[model samples]
Target chain A: MTSATRRHVLQYGLAGCLMGLGSKSLGATTSSGVTDSEIVLGMSAAFSGPSRGLGIELYRGASAYFEHVNRQGGIAGRKVVLKTYDDGYQPDPAVKNTLTLMLEDEVFALFGYVGTPTVTRVLPMLKKFQERQIYLFFPFTGAQPQREPPYGPFAFNLRASYRQETAGLVQNFVNIGRRRIAVFYQADAYGRSGWAGVRQALKQYGEQIVGEATYRRGSKFTGVMRDQVEILKASRPDAVICIGAYAACAAFLRDAVDLGLQVPIANVSFVGSENLLNLITQGRDDGERYTALLVNSQVVPSYHDTSIPAVKQYQELMALYAPSAPQELLTESYTPFSHSFVSLEGFLDAKMMVEILGRLGETPERGALEDAVFSITEYDLGIGEAVSFGPERRQGLQKVYYTVVDEGRFVPLHNWQTRFA
Target chain B: MSMPKLFSMPRLFRKTLFGVFFLFGVIGVSTSLLSIYAVDTHLSKEYEANSKGIAKTIADASVNILLNSNLTALQSLIDQFIEIQGVSYIYITSETGEILAHTFVPGIPEEIKAGDVNSTTTVERSLPGMGDFIEVGSPILAGVAGTVRIGMDTGLIALKIQRAIGQQIYLICIIFVVGVFAAIWFVNYAAKPVDGLLNFAVGLAREQSSDGAKSQELLARNDEAGDLARLFLHFSRPTDGHGKGPQSGPDRSKE
Candidate 1:
């Protein structure tokens, strides 16, 4: 099924029944996951497989902030504890893990979910149990399912949506006279979301995507991507936009370089740019130059720009706590990034969640969460940007950043005209 | 293998019944063998050709994926082909001879992995627990991309042959039962008239030329037996006690 941002599904919660596992789960006194001493938040993200970095790094960033907060004796003397599960970036497992989180584990809320496909499938489950006042807070996706009308009420987003990112990329490409754009995406809900974004953005300029190719989800870096490259190369587009995970995107980039499809390839934030860079370049000066014509769109600013208060704080807390993936969920070993767009977003999500918890006072209740978040009409997130929420505004961020590889790191691409022109 | 004279009928009738049964058996067995052979040969070819076609398709589709070194996509590509009925397994190897993707559970069988990896369009193999298979392999991009191997179940063809043979045997049995019923009906029609003629001759030997009901019944018959009885009556006088008729079996009249 195609993943549309939002529809008017009444009771637009999520898809599964909590088996009546609503407020009744915690009885008449308090919420399900919160006790007098600890506020437990449930998270179901991709902790294994190719997309595991998204889950591991996001969890690490958010939990580092939570750990630091808990050290200072948590909000109003209540510690924030995260309960996590690994979904391997698959929809069925995501749905199953979410049910266990809400029903079996009975967490206070769902948080830090990694992928669009997983969150989209779990949206109906939330819609199914809306009366229980179950809410998903600041999941790691910018897809419309969590931001639009139907399922928007159940989820709150901290990062800019993929549509916003794509709109920015498309506008930038056209501004530099690179209008014939093509797309290489995974053949699933997540890919469809990014592809639709590009299409809608191009329509604003009276143009459309010149070509498109797709690969199955969960493709690895070792895959052959010449077929997809060939399909798009036939259209002879000036630029290509990619919507896929790091491994598959790396393979596509590798094959594109080998097959001589020399055009600027752009990836959205979900591609895990640092991971993509590592897979293709392998940290050796082989002079392969896979990044010679690559651009990436991010919802969060560069973590290297410590001048921003949030970035500085995120780096400090991440180093001080040095959070790691849950030992049980560590199916593979990945060297943690000192700074990345994904982890920064997760840190901000945690910061926002703390602000919400602090507003709830000592005796926190699940029913008061939405109203409390909507009350924040003015707040400085230290990111040099205004972060606010209202009854109508579910997303807290609306900014997108563009970056290109320089000296083996992603630096902001401030001069797009000089490069693409 | 011979049926004895168990019925109260003439020896000639028993001989005719035995001959009919033997002929039916010979024809029935021959037909069964011919049908089994035709199905076995034809189905084997069909399965082999179908497997080769499937292997070639996978090889063509996999070139891009293999060139990209995408084992996951290659596996997914072949997964769609394996669902076809005769396909039991599928595996792909890269140009460098490394196993890229395989549909084996608990890993590929040790025999196939260590043995001759080279396979033509059709290679028959009995892989222990894997049953019989007719393997078909096709090269992608003329061996630049690698090879796609598909193993189709030969046991399925054998099953079809068995089913065909079973139907033929059932038909043969039905004909044999019909023959037995027809033989019983023929014995009743021919044997009774011959017995009547023999009884009349035995009575003439004792000077009892009186026209009994049995004699009258034989004469009233419309068959050749009735003509023979009338001819005997014309040729012999009632006083001629030395009446003649062919004698066969035990003569109970003397006893």
Candidate 2:
């Protein structure tokens, strides 16, 4: 070969080799859990544990939306599928399930993770694969840890935080001229988050929690309620804010009534409103009177409120997708999960996800997904108010609404001033 | 009693020593400076990343507190964050430009309160009490609740850089001293053969018989001194009628 020809060949060959190396170092973009005809999302939540009502209802609701979209040929002609793993509401199992979903199943995202502890445990693992841009979207938690830095980048929340719920609850109590407030909390992240929110809220009125009692996380009464009742009775609080699972809170309330510690009680939306009501009314006298003294803070509008577009859509869609499910059902297990606030929230979350994904165009990736979500500015969710986000804002909802049980059904309280008036 | 002249270094030896000093010194100083710069840049980036992370965290925790107008809890959180090393100050302000909770003394500046900090903002400023610092600000509930800002003291980073530079200087000084000793040994070893050639030439000039052995030893050497030794021996020998030199002269054309 001529000298010039050899030189040219070497030059081009070296350049090509260097370019290949550069691309390798930059890493190839491999889209996981996505295909031409389908996009799969992964979820790890309690499906066979004490918190089963919440996880099952939430999943069913979101799935209902997904099914509805699938019937309409899906978003951009790609059918959405959800892959769920039952973690029993424990951190270790949740971690294992998440790893399996991410590494083995290769899911697009960890969508709708259920509990605060489970989400907290999954956060460090999320950081390890930050480059992959695989985020946990719209987890069913309102804990502050996931909403903060180091974990904020990994997860996005759609619901109002526990802080908002607790603040609303506490503010209403204070406005009604109720002092000497006590807290009954479960000993875990979820309970503590609610407690912290209450403490933070009460600080504004120059009041502090007069009494406090605790139970183990996920405890089912199991003799812990009697001691808590005794402590609460001793404090003689005018009102008690309950931060716990539905069963436990119901047991505590029942015990409090038996001990003649007659007082008004408040609970956050995460307490499983339907489940709590079922537990309170089952095999009990004075159920209506006891129900009247209870108040719950909800992040979403009432499920029966058809005046709202989202609520009407939820009801119609529920009728179509979950025809057998009643508006509210209390089964033999005493846990309730049929057409409730939790399910409504899940449905709303799915709607938002679908909207963002559709706007992302076909073959949506992680960066584009984040951009679409963060760029949302006062976008209507078919609910009364609009939801939004920003570069520093990850959560979408802010308002907290209050509800009280009346004649075996939840009815919205008009306003905080009404309680005092 | 005076030191031998052989111990005294020549101009070439001095030049070689100076050259080594300048070259190694430049290399050492440049390497140290580059390393210092690289490490400082890396650390500064890490600090900035951490600052942003902290600011975001505080903002997240502040939302409900701000919404509830719980200045006491917000203040407690700010005070707790200030206890972290390198954190100089933290503050929160409502959306309507009211200072809710803060770690600032004499309250937040009016400009900061009025500033439209929509996203995570970072600024470097010098002020009284806190000499030089990096301030990071983030919104809690944008256009809803409030915003949070944190300040990090730069003195800690500067101290880290200074310590790194001091260590580099210490190591480079040791390398320089060792290099000086090595340069001395090398100069002596190289000049030994040249000195031998000089002695052989001087003996030949005085027509001393003892110079023959010394000149032969010098000629056996394979260095530049051997060539001069051979030339001196040739001129010292008796010339033939044909005006030719000694036939025993070594061939050095290859060299």
Candidate 3:
């Protein structure tokens, strides 16, 4: 009512508006792991356990690319740092590591998680923390849970679903008149997913799995499974599709070989082809070729195929970077591969993540991450396939490649009939 | 005058009770001891067998996980088995005798670590502070995949046996108390007639006549006591009539 009182109120209002503007300007560094100088992404994968190769190699590959980018002065000039934790390929540990990555380390996004069981468990965490704009990017699993709702919107994938890989394996085998296929898988979500994929693929041809056996997840190669091999052998399967890690699969192969069950054993890419082969043929004077009938399905192009530009770049960058896995994660002595499919996929995931970040411009915010990723209509990954993501499409690649061991190395399988026969 | 009464009852009544109690004490105590032994033996055997079966199943199921050297899954598999009753601990070892997984919380017991639990047969082991155990081992892959050892708690087995024995003891105590009450009631019923006959004889010695009807009443009953009373009346009546009374003796009857 008085002149002095009116003047003071206007002055206070002007000061309050100035403070709001100042806070808004400071908030530009926005999002937990995003800062003016660095953007950190979180990864919770199996850096240990029997499947540690998957996590380690995936990390190594991603790290190789991140290093390459950082050397070129980072993603959009802001250094990209990956905050990683080991889940040992188990679900409970995966959940714990995921929480630590998001809440404690406050990583910008979760990326490169290594297993189906792990990712399925972590999906709920992302859905719950969606308000924080926390999303998982390009996890290294082909399980269907992350590709479908109500968990689909929470993640963006760069690999083909296990369904695609299994279906391709099943179709190829069935076309070769191998209808009586048996399955041996790990007794977990990952295994079940592959089994379901095989079942779904077989349904189209009116075929069913002749026999199935399961080994517990994390089983090692020191144990023998002659009885399991016998169980499957009785089915008189034309072929066996094994959905498991390299250790258990290799051990199964040993028992199968010993039992004289001379049927083709097909393994998915998650089995780690190189590791499986090495495990089967590592010792003894016999030098028996255990991989004579072994086949593996992969989601990425063969690392040996230098004709593909992405593979060329991946092989070069991986060798140049020579990214060794985090030492403590080496828990046991695991000699890193010079180049592999798993690492190649990891390299592609890292490159794609960088491209997505590049779209957010200099000031990247968590709120705009999904849109930035979706905005890419067709980004050439130089793998002869275009990588794309949109509202309707969450995965970038749908191709599946098959490989077989030759001379202790995995080479692309083209002549399926001759090779399998 | 002779021995203090355990319960306020006549000597004959007390004697009858003593006979009953003595018989029951011998039989009840022996039966209880036998039952305790039998139950303990049966449970020990039953639990030992169950634990062995568990160890065997674990060995069969653990082969793949063991072969892969996946200790986490191996640990989880064994951990689930420990939830079974009487199963106290589970330990897994590699083919070369390296430890892979165990269920002990404070670290594997030193005694267990040192004890040879790898035998195919169930072996009994007594740890210093951890009580006794029946350790059973099953060879995975017939010793190619090492062995699975499960320890069934002997202390727990003994405790269950003790609990069973405790209930049996309580039942015996209850039966004894009921038996005593029944004995007391029977004693009161049988002793009343004898007491009547006792007073009559004592009265006759003091030259107090009468109670002939009471004597006849006791004689009318058909029991060993009644028969003895009749025989005594037959002999004493004729002798007293011949000439003996209280004045004939210096009160030979002692009360």
Per-residue C-alpha lDDT of model 1 across residues A1-421, encoded as one tens digit per residue? 1111122111112311232344345552366666656787888888889989889889988988999899999988778988777888987788987887787667788899988778887888999988878899988776777787567899988889889999999999999999999988876557767877888899999998887787877999988898888878988998999989999999999999889998899999999988899898996575247897899999888999989999999999989988888776666788888778888888988999999889988778899999989978768888977888987899888999999988888899998888777
TM-score of model 2, chain A?
0.88
lDDT of candidate 2 over B38-128, digit per residue (tens): 8799888888888888888888987776665544345545655776899987766677655455555322343454555443568886765
Which 10 successive residues of model 2 chain B have the least lDDT summed? B104-113
> What DockQ does candidate 3 have relative to the true complex?
0.03
- Candidate 1, which CAPRI tier? incorrect
Error of 2 at A340 (Å): 0.6
State each model's C-alpha RMSD to the native: 15.1, 18.0, 16.7
In candidate 2, which residue pairs get closer than 3 Å at backbone N, Cα or C atoms, i.e. clash? none
Error of 1 at B169 (Å): 12
* Model 1 stretches with alpha carbons more than 4 Å out: A1-29, B1-255
Model 1, position B106, has a per-residue lDDT of 25
Candidate 1 chain A — worst ten consecutive residues by lDDT sum? A1-10
Which of the two, 1 or 2, has more DockQ?
Answer: 1
Instruction: For candidate 1, report its TM-score.
Output: 0.64
Model 3 Cα lDDT, one tens digit per residue, A1-421: 2243234335433543454455467775555677655688888788777888889999999999999988899866778888667778988878887886787666788889998767777887888888998999998878877787667899999999888988999999988888999988776667767877888799899988787777777888997777678778988999999988999999999889888888788998888877777788887544345778888999898899899999999989987989998764456678889998888888999999999999988778899998998998778988988988998899999999998877668888999899876
Evaluated on CA atoms against the true complex, candidate 2 attains a DockQ of 0.01
Local error of candidate 1 at residue A174 (angstroms)? 0.4
lDDT of 1 by residue, B167-228 (tens): 87887788778777777677756677887877776666566764788888876777767766
